[model samples]
Target: MLLVLVVLGLAAAAWARTASRGWGLAALGVVVVLAAIVLTVRPRPATRLPETGELEVGGRRVTGLVLPLRRPSGAQALGVAVLAVLFLGAAVVTFVTQRPAPPDAVFGMVLLAVFGVLFAVAALALWAASGRVPYVGLTPTHLLVFQETAQVEVPWSDLAGVAPVVARTGASPLPDAVGSWVAVRVRTGSPAASGVKLRGPASRVVTQVPGPTGTTTAALIGDVHWAVDPVLAWWTLSYYAEHPAERRELSGPAAVERVTAGDLR
Candidate 1:
């Protein structure tokens, strides 16, 4: 996907050098293509268990799903599709209604330059969309997230607590077009340290964590929030926490000898 965008962006740049105005359309096309790519890339399924032979967390099972947060709903996708069709129709009508003479060399060059700029902008938009959160994982001990800049792993043990932070839909500076997200507050070890905030549909899982040591409790926010069943996640964790016998930790040579002799228990 990234490769295709790069190729399109390069092509747009070349076209912009000759006809600047064409850049706009090329750029728009790039953004649309990139968005489509992100929406189409399927997320991997959640890990159900640790790799074989590895020591499992004592009395703690880890499990959860990581899904794309900004996926467009059926209605939203249809609406956008309709709008695109209408816009395309308008562009076709305009092209058919007016016939202009060929541009002189200088005019053509200027148009090409404009087109290049537009294409560059579109390519950038595509790049930005690519950075959107791809998925999130809730485990017994941590919250794993793939953000545009980096993979964030928030260990439950490190978290002093969790809370719900609200950002209204259409809120300034947020990436999404509609609906705010439940923000998570990670307590800082020091007073000077800053808390991290995870937002958007990606933040849905954070809201499921038991809390009140964290943030303001809005009225039945859970009803409106996008979240997995907290109880289920909690229950799974609790099972691991209680089943210490299932957990294993490796010991020294005696342990290896016992296993080789088929005396491992």
Candidate 2:
């Protein structure tokens, strides 16, 4: 399909150059229609993944898993890299070649200075994200969210229930910030239960649905839309949450097999 589109685009250009502009415009229109149809008709690509047969990520191995993880799609990283390169490149090019009126020169210099800092910050953030790994744990006794510093966790006994939250919840403006996120609804009224946690840094993209407005609480896991198969992860989490007996296999290879075999459905 891509090849066909490329050929059509080339043909349109050639026709415009060698023949008539009207014919080229018509050909280009046909190519556009075909491209739209192809894009719409095809299934969306799933996120790319590293091999999880061993449940290893970033050279770190896991003893168990509720569900295996997926390598985040590099599209976001690539995009950031591209933007950084373009901004930095533009600044250099402007410095070397662009000559403006006297007053505008200072304005241009400031813009160029800002561009350098932006590129540096973007590259640093990208590097940090690429090397990070997030792991969630549900032991026989507790539900743990592994973090780099001093923190607390919810006990399994404290869990009222777990459900997959796929949509933008409530009137919170936070969800509109990122593309896709999985808000895992972890319901509990215990005091140990942590409150709202947003998708600010490398932590779980979470939003707290405290008991004040409602009888239950929630923890939203965002940014995984680019990480894992959101639907599959949703189902698998729900399956383990709802089926207590099934969780016995969660700490072993059988859990991996269950997830792989579509047993969650």
TM-score of each: 0.34, 0.54
Clashing pairs in 2: 196-208, 197-206
Q: Stretches of candidate 1 above 4 Å error?
A: 1-70, 73-79, 99-136, 146-151, 171-181, 187-265
> Largest lDDT belongs to which candidate?
2
Candidate that scores best on TM-score: 2
Q: After superposition, how far is residue 119 of candidate 2 from its true place, in Å?
A: 3.3
Q: Give the per-residue lDDT of model 1 (tens digit) for 1-265.
A: 3544564455444334433356665566556545545543545334332111222233344443332234223333433343243234323433333346234433433443444454445445445654454444444354444444444455554444333334334324546443323333344452212334445544454454424454322111221322333333233333323444422222223323332344423
Poorest lDDT segment (10 consecutive residues) of candidate 2: 49-58
| Candidate 2: regions farther than 4 A off | 1-62, 66-79, 92-101, 135-138, 144-153, 166-181, 185-192, 200-219, 222-228
Candidate 2 residues 1-265, lDDT tens each? 4543464354343334332354645465455445434433434456642123323322445445533233323444444454444334434544544454255544554564475467558656655654655445544444444332222355555566555433444345445433344343344456545563444432322333332333243344444423456566666666777777777675566776777676885
**Models, CA RMSD each:** 13.1, 10.3
Model 1, position 165, has a per-residue lDDT of 36
